[model samples]
Target: MPATTIHFVRHGQVYNPEHVLYERLPGFHLSERGVRMAQATAQFVAENPATQSLAAIYSSPLDRTKETADIVCQAVNQARRVRQEKPLSVQFDQRLIEAGNNFRGKRIGRGDGALWRDGNWRLLTNLMKPSWGESYRSIASRMTDFTYEQVARYPGQQILVVSHESPIWTLRHLLETGRPEHNMFLRHAALASITSITFDSSTQKVLGITYADPAGGVQ
Candidate 1:
């Protein structure tokens, strides 16, 4: 059995001037530069011979992720000669969504930390388990399950998934170290970055992992 690869793509920058911790808040779409970044990432992936065999594209239901997935699928279809009636067909999965945060609408700037000021200081007790919102272990479990399901369904083909930084990073940490705990301050996935995981088709075990920021130098 041949190995399968899945590319987890983090969405581009949001149009949040206030620097709000958007979290899973609705209506937070991509910014103008973000659109360009998504297009550039699509072009980079499409033109690369390694990703030419991508069979399916999946995305989170959020606006930013959907937009990014659309751009990527369009470019991939054009490059690979796969025709679709719509702009690009993408399957949305809730498991690929951003990590749920208790401070969704709050700004991340100074001011005694919104959560603490809001009397949510109790929620900060466990940073390792991340008592503020969804735990890292939960995020890792959901994402890993989704990835394994896709790997089983599409054996040797490459698959692309548009997701958020938290989930992707958490999943990456879990896969890399076989542990769910990680330092949230350390950023693993960048905006519009690609984290590729290759799995053995027979055992569904991870064979290798790679990271790339196709739109890193764009700005």
Candidate 2:
């Protein structure tokens, strides 16, 4: 049976100075180092045989994700141009967005306007089900929906998807462990990393999962 692979990429570091929880917030873009990280990953994708001939490219609607996806898409297209292949553009999808959080736009430190202040600590009850803005199950459900749709759309091919850490990891955890609930602090999805999942094109059964971090050493 033919195989299909979906490479899920986590967006690079943001330009947040105050260290606020910028979850799902607009106006947050990638940092200077983040651009280099994305460039490294783009180059990796462009040179890697498994991903160079990507059938499609997708990204979360957030600014950070869009920026990273644009960089990768440009690199992929440049490589495709050399082979005289049709170029692919980055398609935005809301399902690939960052996990919702009640702490958005708030710092996680002590004192005024902090996440722990003004009885906000009550939301820290459970990290598994996560008593926060969005449950892990919800994030995984949306991500799974998106992944299955793409798998069917581009059978026997490989595609790239740029998404946030939570959604990507949550879906992976759900598929691999049969549970989406996990400790948020221990997520394996790193910045500018690629988590690829392969499936049987005809049966849609998961074949395997792999990971790579091209920008792991980037400062």
The candidate that wins on lDDT is 2
Which ten residues in a row are the worst by lDDT in model 2?
A: 104-113
TM-score of each: 0.92, 0.98
Model 1: per-residue lDDT, tens digit, 22-104? 88888899999898889888998888877756878999999999999998988987876644433347999999999988877
lDDT of each: 0.87, 0.93
| Candidate 2 residue spans exceeding 4 A from truth | none
Count steric clashes of candidate 1.
0
Query: Of the candidates shown, which would achieve the greatest TM-score relative to the real structure?
Result: 2
Clashes per candidate (backbone, < 3 Å): 0, 0
